[model samples]
Target: MKHIYTDLAVESKEIYNPEKKKEIEGVSVEVADEKNYSVTTVKVLNQKGSQKIRKPLGTYVTIDVPNLDKTDEDLKDEISIAFAKELKALIKEYKKNKILIIGLGNWNISSDSLGPKVIDKVLVTRQYFINYNKEFDETMANVAAISPGVMGLTGIETFDIVKGIVDKIQPDILIAVDALSSRKMDRISTTIQISDVGISPGSGVGNTRAGLTKETLGLPVIAIGIPTVVNAATMVNDTMDLIIHSMKEQAEIGSEFYSLLEGLSKEDKYKLIEEVLSPFMGNVIVTPKDIDVLIDDLSIIVANGLNIAIHPGIDIADVNRYIR
Candidate 1:
């Protein structure tokens, strides 16, 4: 209900691969880059029930999408379309189900609050769809949006806040959004992840609030997030990247390795080098001692990605052209 994101940048919207299929058979994870990026697929096999966590990539679409100078509104349009597409497939199985979009996290803490920023830009369609369908027939219409804030002096648990809303609305589906922590730093501002398993608000930190998952909410829950925060471990990872490149430049076998390395993402190359040079770094941490700005920008990117995923129809060109 509270609109939190400020310093709006409409032009930040970027669709790296418009031709890319919005939904794939499995989730694909990717790291951002100027040219090529890294994509990884995680398999979660021990899950049960009607709901399954489809892919680790579910939480990382925006990182794969290119372009950033976009406004919240533009990104919202993108997010809406993608959400609709995803829901459309789900609705075919459960026509009677209601849909709730919950944005999770605190609005005051900008870096840790991608959910609030995205919720602010979402275009509420429940009322609009109902009115539009009365005159013009349409097949879809049940949806709602909410942001379950982090526990503060309010003492409100995310589960209770979301549950209370769900009790009244009786939605069939719940899609929650929030900021996430990553093992890497460059990934901070470049990743958007989605999942059906819901999320535990503030879990990235030591504060693990009540979970808002499908099992608890008694609805099909989808979670969307971005890695707004990076752990100190990633700094160690980044340093290895530099060391490999430095070592490669000075070795006889370095030329061929350097050529292959140039084509690989910083993450992938780091992994390869790590396997070969495991003896050197027994255990270390090299990332920056500070993470304030990194987290701030990551939150914004995720907020924008959530908006874009739920409302993909927005025209960034129009906004950019008009603003200029």
Candidate 2:
């Protein structure tokens, strides 16, 4: 089978069962359709499920908004509210505890800048809590945020930096945000994945880093990611599939060309495409032309959701008033 590259568990599940017919052995999936978006939850129950999906044993919630790239203020607000609802469910136990938000990515590149951009918009109140030494309200939480640059710029592993902060602050919960890679073009910037399995920084781009997980950090780690790029080979393979389907439609039922097209397995085709492109492209990545605007909009959407989820006192209106 072709090694499908995707940072989404839902996509991995789909790749496991393209027909979406029968159930996997140890995996459970539930999907819900909301007003403007859809939510798909994939839970890897044990080692069996983990091996099948190539994902850690945890809950991965995917939010798909078709119009995310072209969203207006109203749609952004709606998406943020939906995001907050899902995020709130995951961290309900630590709502009032000290929380740390780590934005993991390079801010210099627009396609890889989702994390840092979100940090700029997120509401940080940890300093205020420390200075005054009192809770302003029952809904308030001590929230701190940081955007740790990549190793190339700082000469330090992201995990080391995060571990140092975690040791010092001793937060009850940690949330890490980063950009991801998708196998499909339409999913880029239109999908948000919230998982309890934590994250491996730069893994989507083949730059795997040490993961920030419960075992490594000694706390519950939540990961929120948005797909900002897609592999060029995957995109070309999809286009070839479409072209083959179109050609097959015009061919006679019993024609040799039809049979040949039908017999071409996705794995074989993808491998052939990869072989053809590898020399020149060398793992080329493709992102939308309007990535700057997409990054800007997505950052606000994620930040607003984090604010509303972490700070119970905040809402869409409150976040908008401050962020916008």
Candidate 3:
């Protein structure tokens, strides 16, 4: 299916169907799987809700294999071993000398903390392998990671910060991890995309971070991410769900075997309605009571994917099987 997007005012709007072209304002919306490089706004603010500071959003996949089962340390171990194997393969590509891991995100913001969080956990094999306490030794370390905060504080552009860092350290490869946004909520929990092409930290939002692409960084760049937020249009979808449920209760709407929501109090009714329509709410940061544990469980799975992606010698078949 093709996705059509339009911008109205400061916000961008989107419609997946070309048939909705007449429904959308401004240009005629057409449906095509491929995107026009020039057409930036794929979707404008289709629906409105809370006015939060805008942030660039996309989907990211995170994996953490060890925590698969509460008591199953064996499974976790197996996952880790497998992950190590896969990562080793990827690492072999960087036979060239230096590897720099750039954790891209604003550490201050909870929504953008993925990059920094994962960076802290990375196991720098070179650091521990050969015990040494010398400036040359540290400088010669194969892997070095940095979490360059958002451009807001540093006065310098992201590209410039990376360039300065690069000039000083000179690494062979760059791997960046950051949070992203997704139009669909189902993908929020588990979706990791790795690409050699670097990333634009705040492109989804109006504030564009200096991009860290192969062209800009002058090195091979790999990006890993998880979707941290959903847009307001998803909120509109949630509201419509409530409206539809209310409409469905009307006799004119469903007269045959009336399944009316009659005896429940206002609070109870609202709760029930919300429960019934939760799935339509895209990328919900809030988890339902029943799904809370499940969501938490998935976090480990995502972290494992990232672990395997970075470590370069981990076999992830076991990890992939558990997550799948």
Candidate 4:
């Protein structure tokens, strides 16, 4: 199988079916159009679906905001609401339980700083509950967060750090936020993927560590990720597709050139592109020029969604007030 590096499960499904027509045996997909964005739910139902998509058996919700690059408050709110709705559905049963949010990334890098930035804005009430010994209120649940730097900086495995905290705090559930890589350029910084199967930190960049899942943590883990980068080879492959499409449009349908273009296999082309770029730019990752600003806006959107979803007492209006 041709390895296509993408953190979004929707992309994986798309790759599985380039024509977007056939349905995988055990996988199911449903898409709903929202006011400002669209929600795509891709479920890997069983082992067959899991192996077909190369994803674990779980639900992956992708919030696609086409105008994500635009800095508009209304758009942000709409996306945040959609995000909260999806996240709420996933953790509805544990809404009143103790939740630990782990922000997994390096704060120094702009592309990878989303996790830490979100931690800055998320409402953390666990400290209050611990210090004052306050009982659970309707307005807020016991929430705690940590921005554990990458292993390179902390010299400690992320899972170890999280395990220790989980053992100490004994939170009922875990929510991990991190930056991810996508196969499409347009998805970079514009897509949010929420999954119930948990995530392997640094997996998108090929430095995968121990996975943070129910099997490992002994608690349900919800992973929320935004694509901050895309593989350069994948971008080139997409560009090639566009070019071929443009040529085919101008050429006669029955012409030899048109036939050749139609017969060009995406998998073979992607492999060729990867081979050609390997020597010059081995596993090169690409991010948008405005990634810094994109991350700032996205972090706020994600934090607001998380705040509203995890704390029923907080709504969109009150969520921004808590964010710096």
| Ten contiguous residues minimizing lDDT sum, candidate 4 | 253-262
Candidate 1 has an lDDT of 0.50
Question: Once model 3 is optimally superposed onto the true structure by TM-score, how far is the C-alpha of residue 301 displaced, in angstroms?
Answer: 5.7
Model 2: CA > 4 A from native = 253-255
The C-alpha local distance difference test score for the whole of candidate 3 amounts to: 0.49
lDDT of each: 0.50, 0.90, 0.49, 0.90
Q: Residue 21 of model 2: what lDDT?
A: 93
Task: Report the C-alpha lDDT of model 4 over 161-221, residue by residue, as the tens digit.
Answer: 9999999989999999999999899888789999999999988878899999999999999
Measured over all alpha carbons after superposition, the RMSD of each candidate to the real structure, in angstroms, is 10.6, 1.6, 11.9, 1.6
Question: Which has the higher lDDT value, candidate number 1 or candidate number 2?
Answer: 2
Q: Give the TM-score of candidate 4.
A: 0.96
Q: Give the TM-score (vs. native) of candidate 2.
A: 0.96
lDDT ranking, best first: 2, 4, 1, 3
| Per-model TM-score versus the true fold | 0.57, 0.96, 0.53, 0.96
Decide which is better by TM-score, 1 or 4.
4
**Model 2 over residues 158-272: C-alpha lDDT tens digits?**
9999999999989889999999999889899999999999999988777899999999998999999999999898899889878777777786764567668656766677688
lDDT of model number 4: 0.90
104-156, model 1: which lDDT tens digit per residue?
77777756666766666554557765666542223333556777676683587
Error in Å for residue 40 of model 1: 5.4
